[model samples]
Target: MGLKAVLSKWFAAWANRELEQIRHNAVQLQQATFRQLIQQAANTAFGHDHAFTQIKIYEDFKQRVPVRDYEDLRPYIDRVTHGEANVLWPGKPAYLAKTSGTTSGVKYIPISKESMPEHIKAARNALLSYIHETGKADFVDGQMIFLQGSPILNEKAGIATGRLSGIVAHHVPAYLQKNRLPSYDVNCIEDWEQKVDAIVEETYQADMRLISGIPPWCQMYFDRLSVKAGGKKIQDIFPNFKLFVYGGVNYEPYRTRIEESIGFAIDTIETYPASEGFIAFQDTQQDKSLLLLVNSGIFYEFIPAEEYFNEHPTRLSLAEVELNKNYALILNTNAGLWGYSIGDTIKFTSVNPYKIVVTGRIKHYISAFGEHVIGEEVEQSLMGVARQQGVDVVEFTVAPQVNPPHGGLPYHEWFIEFGKAPSDIDAFSQQVDQALQQKNIYYTDLITGNILRPLVVRSMKPDSFINMMRAKGKLGGQNKVPRLSNDRKLADALADYVI
Candidate 1:
């Protein structure tokens, strides 16, 4: 066998064995792993004072380390950035990934040398797992394109800082870097649109086999690539394309459009890697659920989503997390993030092997009129309606119009950016309304009882959401339009560009 093929086979075999072990004893590994994580960082300033050494199980750990958000731990992170030894972790972090969500301008997430291996291993093993399960080893031999954020690194508070993806790109294994496309120069462009233009020029006709990135940005790349290929499908540009590896956003809403762009079916892998840590990935194609990363250097916790925003929440360990409840994710990592509320919500699909689906963000919810609509409902409803309508959704957000223009009762206002605008706009709105009502009974009752009007749909002029993101300094790289908002915060900003 050729050298590349031989190496791929070896790696696949190793990963398969590891996956088996993880599946067999996921809960045990999870508990033991947290204990190890505490022990590993026990001497660090945060851990030593918290009595990490005395904590033997999940309950004790929870009692000691209360769940905290990024702002709550910002002081310690500041200490780490300023070169304080053992402030949060031992010594200093190797890098601090800068992540900005809908509201937070930028939060520096520590990447410790001790925890870096988990980050590296999770990424590699995810791909290897895909190869083992799907027998798709040809990608390793051919080019892979990462529609990454700027590779521009800045020295901030005595640490290297950039988007997590860029930091990861900078650390791509030397061997594989040789086969990755869109040169470093193209990857360095700060502007999202400009960078996409450069990327299109760099990789349109390359023999690329794998593509990875956030869905919205990758869609931008694919859209431009299709145009550059003279309106040909993605398969025509890179015939050997085998995988669409993605994270940072749900791919369901974009799947139909992406498949249409690619012109054929291909294998896909989903990961739930956040700035805090690598959480989960689609381990086997059979389940279509993300297997939790028990072996990664992070201890996990889940707070029931309903109680998460309350003053006190009941925190549960992997063993206690029940299936089908939306729980806000929490973590204590070897990287020195202790009991940090990651702000994302997830639901356990399977507890045996510990698989989960990200349901929404803790802050991304709408309960303006007691109708609690979350990210999952909005995404699933949109996907279902768009798929049935034979249309492509670009970007969307829903806000309760508390102040109705005609002195009527309050109602939802949907601002959508459509790649292919649907004909019969009223029918499209009805479909969207029906889909949401089917998913959320409260929403249905609000309309059925005449408490709220049918949702108002306003198709946005193309690029409005992009402009909004740009205005907010969150143009790309993991930042997303909040799927649902309690107030007209984003809706007011986006309505100016309605068609």
Candidate 2:
């Protein structure tokens, strides 16, 4: 056996052992790990500032730190940028994971020494989880194409800063780096188009067994690879392509397209990773829910999503979370982000084993007129209507049409990028509207009371979202267009939201 295979086997056993222990007592593990982190960092500035030493339990932590978002932590982050050490973590973070958030334009999340091992462990465990279940470890012997950002990062006071993918690129485990394709030179090409071209050139004939990325960009690469190989499916080019590791967005809408591009069905593992941390990952093929990272260097809390917009909401610990309720995730990390709201909403599919499904983004919703429609609801409705109409949605976003130019009635507007346009656009719009009304009662009340007109469906060119992504320089890797915009900011810019 080759060195890579032997290495994979050894790592798999170690990771799976750690995973099994966490699963043994997920809640107890989270509780203990959280306390240990607080105690370890009690001497640090942030910890001392928050009285972490005085905090005995989750309740004490809640009382001391309170929930915060990126904006609230900006001052601390700014201090870090100006070379302040131990502001958030024990020392200045060696790297920052930069992201353009849908709401917060730019964010610099600290990647601290304390959390580096956790990040590495989560990634290894994710891959090992799949191997443990499937008993397929041969792919590690071949290439694992990581579709990532430019690896060359700019330094801020001796601290590296770039997209999370780039930050991770600089630290990929030396052994696994051999299995990763696209030379550092190719990866350092900042231009997305040029970088993608270079990656294809380097890996087109390599022994590619796994392709991992955000689905859209990976699909883009496959499309390019097909054209380069005279319209052959990705499977034709990489015959042993065994797994597609994907994250950064829901895979349901893109699954059909990706499978078609690949020419054969391949196993896929979904991960819930963010600039803040690697949150959870799919562990079992039989069940679709992701197993929460209870023992990672992160402490978790949740506020009921439906109640968060109220004057006050309850913040619950891991043990307090109820099954199948949408909750906005709050995280306290070893990286020194105390009680930070990650902004994503999730639902627990299995409370005992701590399995979750990402429900929506807290800031990404349509609540213009008190009819709060979330991302999960919108996606389900769109997926259902498309399936019914025998169409595929390339990309989509929904917004509230609260004001009409001519003082006309208000409505919900959908800007849809479709692979196959419905035979009758009007009929499709009705289906979307009705499906939403059936799912959301407040929406039904709006229609029943004549507060709004029928929802609008504007067919967008398939590449419309791509154009927007290109303009944002966030075409892939943990960056995603919000599925539901509470305001007209993004919808208005698209022009398709215009009634």
Candidate 3:
């Protein structure tokens, strides 16, 4: 066998062993270890902070750390952006994963090799769980597809120069490299402009069995592939393409178009990917994803959604976290971020201590549709509609907009990009509306009041939204398009979002 093939085999075996060990440790030592992790952070980092130290000295310890928001970290981030080391911990971070900030300029997030284990473990577990849950791995070598930001590394050297996705790509074990489509090594080096051409050039001939990435961009690439193959259809291009793996953002808007263009239904897997680390992945037949690497290398904290929005919210330790509760995620990782809120909301689906569902962004609310649809609700509704339609989609997203009034009432708008074409758009929309009504009572009430109507699907050129997000300085080599924007500013700023 070739060296790459041999490495792939060896690495897969090693990764599986590691996952089993992690799972055992998570179940066995989770509680005490989690507590120890908190104390360690306090002693190593938090204790050094004057404010935190003062609280400790005063015997005024709160059950949780005072809640932190992005704004709260601005001073530290400013220091980092301007080349501040030792702002949060000792030593300079190995790299900064540049991502966008709300109402602010760019954020250069710190990343380190110490944090690599959690990120790598999370990724590996995603596939393992996918296989265990879907029973697909028993078949032929399942080809996997990853739809993500271009893996291109920054030209400059140092942590500040590398994107999170790029850094992860760089560290992917060489053994797994053999199994990855588009080869992470190759994809991680090419510039964005060269990527589509590269994908079109290679993937057009690939018998791709698995696909992964953000939904919009995936749709865009497949659309180009379809056209290049003279409308041969996605199935024809990659008949082996059986599963779609997606994360980084919601898949509602682009699902319909992706399935339509591909001319067939395909199984989809969703994950919660963060620059700080990969946190969760869909593992069971149920809608919720299993927390894959809880005890891998990071200690987690949760701030209630309500408290998280407050000026000074408090966070809960993992020991205090419970099920079916919405909370803003705070993370302390080996990467050196302490009490850091990653700006996402999540909920535990069960009390078993190892599964979660990403609920929404702290501030992403959709009132245009009167649905008040957040990320989690939108995902549930989209999946419901897709299952009802017997549609297996690769990727999707939902954007609420003011529909041109038919009778003086604004309607909820949907900017849909899909791979498979459903037989009926209006019928499909009604189905979506029904699903949302069932998923969220507020949305149903809004629909009944005519404050919002069923979703209106707006067709755009393939990759329009993905390009738009990139243009707006919102997306980069590794980040994703924001799921919900109240004004549809992203929809209008196509040139800027795409570049």
- Native-referenced Cα lDDT, model 2: 0.84
Off by over 4 Å in 1: none
Measured with C-alpha atoms, the lDDT of residue 250 in candidate 1 is: 83
- TM-scores for candidates 1 onward, in order: 0.95, 0.95, 0.76
Q: In candidate 3, what are the lDDT values of residues 1-499, reduced to their tens digit? A: 3444344455555656665655555544445444544444454334456344434311243433454555776676566556655555455567777666666556666666566666777776666655555545521254455544545656323444555666676677665565666765547534554676676776777667777776656766787897889888898888767777788766665566677877886777787778776777776556646554666556677788867656667667655677888888887666556667788888877655457777778777676644557777766776677767775544345656576545655665566555454678778878877877887798888778877666776655555655666565444345555566677665566423221
Pick out the ten consecutive residues of candidate 1 with the lowest summed lDDT. Answer: 98-107
What Cα-based lDDT does every candidate model obtain?
0.84, 0.84, 0.63
Cα RMSD (angstroms) for every candidate in the order listed: 1.8, 2.0, 5.2
Between which residue pairs do clashes occur in model 2? none
Q: For residues 94-205, what per-residue lDDT tens digits would candidate 2 score against the true structure?
A: 7888877655787889988878777777877888888877778889888888888887788887888898888778778887788888888888887777878888899999
lDDT of 1 by residue, 1-499 (tens): 3467569878888988988877788888887888788877888888877898888877788778888888888888888878787888888888898876445657889998877777778888899998787776888888888877777889976788888888888779887988997898888888888888988888876889899988888888888998887899998888889799999888887787788889987789998887788999998878778988888888788889889878888998888888899998998887889889888999999977788999988888878877888999988887787878777888888888988878988888889889887887788888888998998999899899988888888999988888888997777767777788888878889978898
